[model samples]
Target chain A: MTTQASVAPLDRAPAPETPFFFPSGDRPLYAVHHAPVAGRANAPVVVHCHSLGVEQVTCYRAEVLCARAAAAAGFPVLRYHARGHGDSAGDFADATLARLIEDALAAAREALRRSGATHVIWLGVRFGALVAASALPLGPPAAGLALWEPVQSPRDYFRAQLRGLLYSQVAEGRKPTETVDDLFARLDRDGAVDVHGYYLHRALADSVRDVTLARRLETWNGPTFLAQIEQRRSLAPAHAALAEALAARGAKVETMRVPEEPGWHMVANPAWTSPELVAATAEWLRAVA
Target chain B: MPWRESAADLDRARAERPIVVPSAFGGLVGIYTPAAPDVPSAGLCAVLLTRPRSHRNRMWVEGARRLAAQGFACFRFDYHGTGDSEGPTGPLDPNRPYRDDIVTVLRVLRAQLGGRRFVLCGACFDARTALSAFADEADAIAGLMFMAAPVVELDTLVRVDADRKDWGHLARSLRNPYNWKSLASAGRWRYMATVIGRVARRSLGAAPAGDPPLGAAFVEHFQALLRSRARALFLYGRDDAEYESFRIAERTAFAKLTPEQRARLEVEVWDGTVHGFLEMKRQRETFERALGWIAALHPARAAAPARTIPGDATPSAVAG
Candidate 1:
């Protein structure tokens, strides 16, 4: 005389994250992949692209949280450091735009091979989104692309970084011996300029400054998800325009306006969590799956 | 000639042996061994880099790789709660007893590399950790290389607080006609006067060097190391005024030591660099310098069997 509830199935626990290294070129890229806990139909292998420099460090915890969420939601997740960044075997001073794109493509292929998902999805933030966009033509066809606060123009991004360098100098009460023009001149003359700690080399800088995502994504008609941060209720006007443009390109587009505090800027705090963004992204990914 | 050249160089030397050691608190420690060819004949000192408190061991990877490439075996590891290491954050404290973690890593590293000579390298709060760990196990280790270490007096700290590099920008801004026009306002004039007085007071050493909370006696710790004939390197950036304060305090401490003890310590400053040596060129330079210093301090005793021991050598010769 056994009760009906006595033999109920136990809830499946999420897979423990595994850290390993796989090669893109001669260099090994440090990667952490989380296998899906429960089997789901038509699941996409999610590959995360991290932003560069300090952002990469600060955003790591958030990335881990999101990756765990995706894994828990029954999606196989892969997050990796780009060439010359993080635990990867390369020098950051030598990283170029083309190289980053190639790395993204390599990562996608590897993720697909490892996860055996029906299709691949690219989830990236800041400069990482640009890498994902540029790799589209080279990589396996993506099932979906999710960009969080993607930079519209590389030139604008570079300019903003320069402004930040200037601001740091000014705040220190030290007059920069070289002006912005002088720095550009040095880059032209010597093929690189030391801005703060980063070396803005000729090849990387030229390629980055010339990248216009709007132009590159014009014909890319995939399922696109754009998450923009907003302090108030309405969507940012620029993000709305980008969404409209993508939708016009024959892709099913979804927009989510997350809270201003997205929790990816503090390296010291390992407990920082972005609940709204994580919930939104997980829900959207699950529905699509 | 191409951007890929550097990457190629790094890749060639990028062999890392990733190992996880069990810690005391039922947790695992993540350690990465640099891809260095082991030369047991050279008796090269192995370096154990401590984590810089909040920073997750990523900052020291480049330095470790560079050292390994130059013949020294380098190991970088995360403490209990940081990086990929497993542990609850509750039990991990930088100020409290963490010497067990350091000793465990060293013991495991010694077993793996089969090297007796060891050097502890750390920066910032990590420097404090290295110093404390060395103090506890001075008999086991050879030397230390500390960067931007906290070893400052109240006066030096105040002086560092007053120093600034904004004079060039300030002069240019003041000369601008637009600024003059704006300065006509009473509020602007008052603000300018306040700033000017503050800067002037700071520069003139009028600020009080009030008693502030001090950590462990850093000078005393170094003196102990020096007395034992253990070599030390204190590195700082010129732009980091706080480390400059440390430089001044450390020099004052050195004045009280005998020549033999003084000879065991070396202080270096890198110009046009920040505390972390964040710039690529400077970072490389720092690594090279550390390698050179290590070579000088702990030369292959096997190579020159009859050579005079560093401890027994003339103080002037050691300093030179």
Candidate 2:
């Protein structure tokens, strides 16, 4: 047994990535700061916004992989659990798009201060990407933004989540006593509805559904990198359409379509990592830097 | 305790540094330790929260903090391969019967914080691991909390899954005739045929027996645990059918236990909740119940009791 008394209490070596909890409100947000190695002393720090619920659970390993790769490529990174998510304070049911944006802004400022980086770049995946876009105003003198398979519409995403919940209930031989309309009504009446295991509040649903990234992408004039993952041969039409729209807005956009299974959904396999995705991301950050 | 780091120091360091738990397996495992209590109390009790098989330590992070706020020391760690722990990725093996990781963590807690009375809490499959680990040293644990622990018969589980899927198919077809209409198409029929075949294979006689039944050993451990008079809490979701299957298995196992042994067990089922206590309100209630039980089992004259249970707030204190 490795007891504290038995093992020599040698101090841990200074790691490039320093983990800490930063203030948000009543509960502090859990965050990790990946300091750039010696060579990139003045590198731009990237703040990572994680995906929601099950996606966050499964893609954690991938997120770690991506952070390490980014750090190796000389980008100091700050990845945090937003309020009501991960190690952060507050209940998941109380989460709102506004609160998430506020939390992201706080994380970016903390990262910039701690890493001594001049600029903040928001790197987000899935719903996290949408948050990054919405939080753009909070991070001033933005270096760039990276969006990975960002959710096109919050309403559509929530609907899909509801379908999964229904399918599971049915698969388990129990009929979900509530329908989609019933859930919306419950959210309106009770201010919250339990979907799967997450508590979805009316305020959160209403605010998130109003978020349209296609309309907001032009607001971010900084260099942008958008990567989409696809299971089949061709890129998803929605992703292509997004890339075209960003380009039309006169934004410097670099789009890449990596053919691979969605890592966020594969929770069983913890070691699942998309080498191509990580490589493409690192390369894009290098080009932009 | 003079040789160990204080909780306040740990907290200060945590705010500025990454905290890693040293593993017996030659590498550091990632851990989220709640800030140690400001004033160290005598006979300080600590809780070690383990993951649900595939999940990392994040599931128990919030609960750990709640326990810490209540003046108990808490540690949430990723087992060797999962989370940020240093090890090759793979499922935790319950059969191998070795838990050097858990022992190492306990030893660290005892040595560092003077935490003598420890509570081992596990969710789902991890409950079995915690139980097995505590069985060897029953004298050490103050309590054991099992959340959605699976002690179900394999055949029962398979049947339940098939029945549920069948009901789902029927309900959908009834609700939307288009579902039945789609079955008229060749592709839909083939899909339906595949589903039927799969279900048939999983049935008791047709399916290949994979894992050996936990059988008498599962009950034996509990009996031994209760003989030692350690408190045990079984919290499951009322809506979970799989847990119902586990309850059936438990009934058979508990039939042999003495009433005295059964008296040590406490079970709580949250109505309208899912398997993992996914909703925040339910999670809070579950934590509150756990706090109440922990307080009652090892009541501290100095500490304040948790919030009162309004009517059904109290967990059913059933005799085994």
Alpha carbon lDDT of each predicted model:
0.63, 0.63
Docking category of candidate 2: incorrect
Could you give the interface RMSD of each candidate, to one decimal? 7.9, 10.0
Clashing pairs in 2: A173-B164, B262-B320
The 10 consecutive residues of candidate 1 chain A with the worst lDDT sum are A1-10
User: Candidate 2's error at B283, in angstroms?
Assistant: 5.9
lDDT of 2 by residue, A1-289 (tens): 0011111111121245565788875557777776665576567888888887657666665566567677766788888888766666565666788888889988988887888888888888888888888888766668888888788888877777766677656644467788777777777898765654455667788887667777667566677888777665655776677777777777678777666655343355335556566667777777778
TM-score of chain A of 1: 0.86
User: Residue A266 of candidate 1: its Cα lDDT?
Assistant: 28
lDDT of 1 by residue, B197-249 (tens): 55777668776454343334565556557556567777776657556566455
